[model samples]
Target: MTPIEILNKIVQAESNAREIYSEAESLREGFDNYVNKEIEEIRKQYYERADKMIAEAKERETARAEAAIQELDKKLEAELDAAKKHFEREKDAVVLKIFKLAVDADA
Candidate 1:
């Protein structure tokens, strides 16, 4: 081939290689974007699940505390009732003794 024709062929080959390289780079960028989007979606779902689990645990703890408080209140009420009954019986006995002493002194 003549010198000018060889140079033309080389230029054409270089152009073709440049086009192929550009196309491959574009495809790689698109794939990377798609993978990043998928990862973000998965992360959002994980955070949502974690929040729901925490709320459920808090509700269960509150219920347990309420049950314990109710049990304590019942026990305290029973003790107070017994104490009041004993105090009333003692007061009546003392009043009766004072009345008997007054009656004997008058006689």
Candidate 2:
């Protein structure tokens, strides 16, 4: 690519990240207030990594930026999976507790 095109691409990437960041901020706010504490923390980590990548890209195409992004994605997915399992366990416990209460009441 030409020098100008490369610069343009970098600028576009930054702009795109900025736009997504605004949306991500909203999501983080909602997550903080509402639900999924685990995911909310993961999302915050993701944005931080992404911001770093954007800054790194400004210097040059680092060999590690893409790998860093992929790592972030994998980490986020794993955290979400763990959160889901935790929620499922909690739900089951709630149900079992309610059932036990009912049985005790009947007895």
Candidate 3:
């Protein structure tokens, strides 16, 4: 080949290599963007599920505590009623005993 033709072929080959490199770099950037967006969406879904579970647990605990309080109130009311009935049955005897003690002290 002539010297001038040989030089032209070398320049053409270098230009083709540069174009291939640019195309490969652009494709790599596009793939990276796609992966990052997918990761963000998955993270968002995971947090939402966790929040739902926490709210459900709180509701169940509140209901259990309220039920325990109601049972305690019922027991307190029954004890108070029994005490009232016992006092009513013994009040007259207690009053007569005090009156007899007062008369003996005066003598």
lDDT for each candidate structure: 0.92, 0.91, 0.91
User: Over the stretch 10-104, how does candidate 3's per-residue lDDT look in tens digits?
Assistant: 99988989999999899999989999999999999999999999999999999999999999999989999888898799878878889889989
After superposition, candidate 1 runs with Cα above 4 Å error: 91-107
Q: Write the per-residue lDDT of candidate 2 for residues 11-71, one digit (tens) a residue.
A: 9999999999999999999977777777788899999999999988865656577778899
For each candidate, how many residue pairs have backbone atoms clashing (under 3 Å)?
A: 0, 0, 0
RMSD of each: 5.9, 31.8, 3.7
- How would you order the candidates by TM-score, starting with the best? 3, 1, 2
lDDT of 1 by residue, 1-107 (tens): 99999999999999999999999999989999989999999999999999999999999999999999999999989999888888797978878888999998899
Return the lDDT, model 3, position 7.
93
Give the candidate number with the greatest lDDT.
1
- Model 3 weakest lDDT span, ten residues long: 86-95
